[model samples]
Target chain A: MTPVLQIKNLQVSYYTDAGRARALDGVDLTLTAGEKLGLVGESGSGKSTMALAMMRMIKPPGRIEGGQVIVDGTDLMTLSEQTMLKARLSKIAYIPQGAMNSLNPVTRIGAQMVDAIKAHDEGSSRADIDRRCKLALESVDLSSSVFKMYAHELSGGMKQRACIAISILLKPKVIIADEPTSALDVVTQRQVMETIDRVQKQIGAAVILIGHDMGLMAQFVDKVAVMYTGRIMELSSVRDMFTDPKHPYAQALIRSLPNLENKGVFNGIPGMAPALLQLPGGCAFHPRCSKVMENCKTQRPPSTNISGGRILECHLYSEKA
Target chain B: MIKLIIRRLLFLITVIWAASTIVFFIPRISQKNPVRERFATLAISGGFSPKDLEVIIASYNTKFGLDKPLFEQYTDYLSSISRFDLGVSYNKYPRTVLELIMDSLPWTIVLLLVTTVLSFVIGNLLGAIAAWPRAPRWLRTFATPFILLQGVPPVLMGVLLLFFIGFKLKLAPLGGAYSTGVIPDWSSLTFIWDVVWHQILPGLALLLGSVGGWTLSMRGMGITIQGEDYVNFAEHKGLGGYTIFKDYYLRNALLPQATGLALALGGVVVSAIVIESQFGLPGIGRVLDAAIRSNDFLVIYGVVLFVTIAVATLMVLMEFIYPLLDPRIRNE
Candidate 1:
């Protein structure tokens, strides 16, 4: 099966007051057609940075430093800004973070959705556009009357649904949803996720679900990649990653998930990730890893595929063994 | 809305009446007595009769009914205000306070209203361009120099421009709307030409410094509005550039500034006293300046009251008009 989106050795950096800071470093990932991949990382782990770099949405003082983000077959980094804008809304839709504030407050919800569809397809008739807009809203379980209501009048969940509906209306080949449920309550989060899942199947599109919640990712994504310190620590099938995580950082992350029975008690990963401007000499996570060896301190680990179709960047599993 | 407007009007009327009454009493109730001043003037002129002066003063006071209760005095003041008879000029030879003000009122309104509105419109447009991201380099460069031009005082600007453009160049008349030989005509075209010709110097002086501040304000407002989340959301929704600027940014920013401008209208007219005097223009400002210098209390009081009422009424109108511009402010 041909991969729908292929990001090869991508690096994103920002020029801050201090100096140049690498946000995402050499990220290599792929998603096959109709595949759902979960990008699980804490804030500042370059998850959103990677997604924004793909869309060329990084404002100046921040830019994609190196490598390519190949969406379908076209290399996005090579495309001009104007062309990229066309690709952005039409081919690969982005449901940005803070979806509630994403719609214009003065305009009615329905007009904005139709505008999005019209922006991508100029030749589409007004009647067809209106029909698609109503269908899109209905698909998200929102009332058709919501189209008539202004943005401020809609509830937070409804706004999120409206944004999602607008993003997916064009039936883009790939959807990059950056924390679509982070601002929502638990129940609303579930509904939004279920909507995304249903839309993914209906459109038969690839999706990159980037968020910090691992348990939520497990419920829907076909694969999961745990990232830390601007690097992918582990990539595996969702079931395997949860069952037996090899990377020590991945293990610590899974152990940190709160237990339902003991609500008050939680195990959190010890120590902070290394600063991007000052990454450790070798393995960035060595200081935080429990099984850190002498070799792990001064040498970066190469990503090696292990048994059970799991890939890990750790010195624990040797090729000789 | 009707009740709100009515309440505002009533409140404004009460305030104006109170202010006018206070002004009326300043020469009488204050330690600098009008009686003493009158006596001093008579004595200086070699006229003798303290007893005769006292009787005359008493009679005069009684005739005006100043010996009555304060509330009764206030009622009389209100009655006189309603009739547009704000008493006679204490110093001007044979003119009532109303007559003096009426002569200059038209000139003041024409100068102030025309210049203020023109500056506001022009400055705001330039400001929007300066704030627009895609605005060409020429606009950005021009705005800087224009702001520098704004810093010059209007009086200085008036003197310089009057000397260069009027005296040296002889491009326009030095002062007044028409030549001495020409009679004032009732024709609409000639009347407009007369008004425009008389307004040239004062208008240019006012525009010189004021437009800069207006431009700066509009530009600042544009920048601030551009940063608002709604503007970005508008862009993301693919709104046309001009429409976004007009409805989203300009409309919201212009609301409060428009109110400030309206409230300033009366003050602008009153405050142009120096400019009018310098140009020899027959406006209320020039007349008010002369009245104050001559201690013409009645004329001074009348001009003050007229200005106070005009400003207050404008403010009330602004309050009523605000809701139509900003939907969020409606009913609040």
Candidate 2:
């Protein structure tokens, strides 16, 4: 089956004061229908940038230097902003980082919803719009009264849910959620995560979940792709990757997690992700990898497929597919 | 709320009283006394004897109630103010200080109020447009020159522009609210045209300096507010421009501007003096300047007291209006 979202050899760079910072480099990924793929990476690993590039929402100083973000059959990179906008909220909805920040504080949430809903379908009637808004809120476990309240009145989790509701109201075929639950408290995070999972399943929309916490993403997503320094380090079924990861970096990451089944000291990743502007030669993660060898410095590894449909990029995976 | 109002009212009263107290004494404390100046002028010009001068001074002092103790004099001054009697102008010789102020009051109000509101509205709109993310750079390119012009002092601008635009270019009248040949008429059309013609110089002076500051401030407010989460939310929703303007820019920007306006109300009244004098416009500022020069104490006192009270009252009114514009303040 054709993928719902196809990103081919995507590269994004920003012209900052310090010079060109490669936000994403030669990254390739895809999401199929009803697939919940978690794009896992630390803060500067380009997960968020990839999502923004897909929507053609990248602002100045940041440019998608080379990329083709194909959603359904249309390539968004070639589309005009006006056409991209029609695609943006309707074909692929984006739940931005902070839900509260994604709402107009002075406007009623319902009015904002109607505005977003009508922007794509100008012919939508008030009654139908109101019904859709009510259903949207209800689908996310929010009461219809919540729509009357301004953004400031809602708790962090409720705001996130409301944003999610707005995004899913049009039943976009693909949803790019960038760190939706990252800012919420543990209980609220659980509730928000549950709501996202429930909604995506009910709508059967492809979800590109962007986050840094592997453990959290593992609990909710079907597949996981680990990123480092703007490059995908590993892509696999979450179960297999957790059970028997091939990449040393991925293995170290999973081993570093605090296991509730065993009492032990939990260690975070040894070093930070490489700075995109000053990335090391060859494999970017080689500097932090304990199993690093001399070959890892001069030669960039081609992706090698391993057990259970996993892909790893390392000198150890030097062989091509 | 009542206590707050009472407290504010008392504070305003105290400020006005302090203003009157200063008005009564600051001029008297100046190196030359009005009595001595008048006596010397008469003596040098060979008009009066020593006894005549002394008698004249005593009579004038007694008539103005200046012969009494300072506190008693203060009470009398306050009482007269309460009774709406601003006393007589010594230099103007016959007209009461109240009548002089009343005559000039309309001209100043027409110039200042109209210019202030115009600059504020236009400046803020331009500022908001200039700060928009995808807005054409031409907006800022065009707006910067106006802001630069606003920075120049109003008196200097008023005089220079008056010379260039009025005298040299001969586009408008150089001074006065109406032609000297035209008699003061009360017909609506005549009144409107007279006010408009008279407003030209002073209005330009006020707007040239003021519009820039308002534009710069409003642009700054716009840039800051655009970063606000609520504004970002609106952009994502792709709402209409007017809705964005009202909900995002106007709602957020008005609070700071209102607070500035409260202080402006006080500062604004004193500011027109230089421009008013430059234009030779019959306004409180020009009268106040002449009063200071001639040591016409009653007229000077009357102008200072009236402006202080007007400013104080406007500021109090601003305090009441602030809460409605700013939810944060209202909640407090």
lDDT of each: 0.79, 0.81
True contacts kept of each: 0.15, 0.32
TM-score of chain A of each: 0.95, 0.95
Residue-level lDDT tens digits of model 2 in B1-332: 88888989999888887888878788877654455566666677886667667788888778766678868977887788878789898777578998999999887877788887888777777777777766678766666877889778777888888889899999888887677788777777877687688788778878878877877888898888878766655555545556667777677866688777667656767667888888788888889998888788889889998888888898888888876665345443
- TM-score for candidate 1, residues paired by index: 0.81
Ten residues in sequence with the least summed lDDT for candidate 2 chain A:
A99-108
**Which lDDT tens digits does candidate 2 get at residues A152-216?**
77889999999999889888889988888878888998899899999999988999999877767
What DockQ, between 0 and 1, does each candidate earn?
A: 0.24, 0.40
TM value for model 2: 0.89
Q: For model 2, state the Cα shift of residue B108 in Å.
A: 0.9
On a 0 to 100 scale, what is the lDDT of residue B104 in model 1?
84
Model 1 Cα lDDT, one tens digit per residue, B19-88: 8878867644544434345556767887765767777767755755656776787678778878888887
How well does chain B match by TM-score in each candidate? Answer: 0.83, 0.90
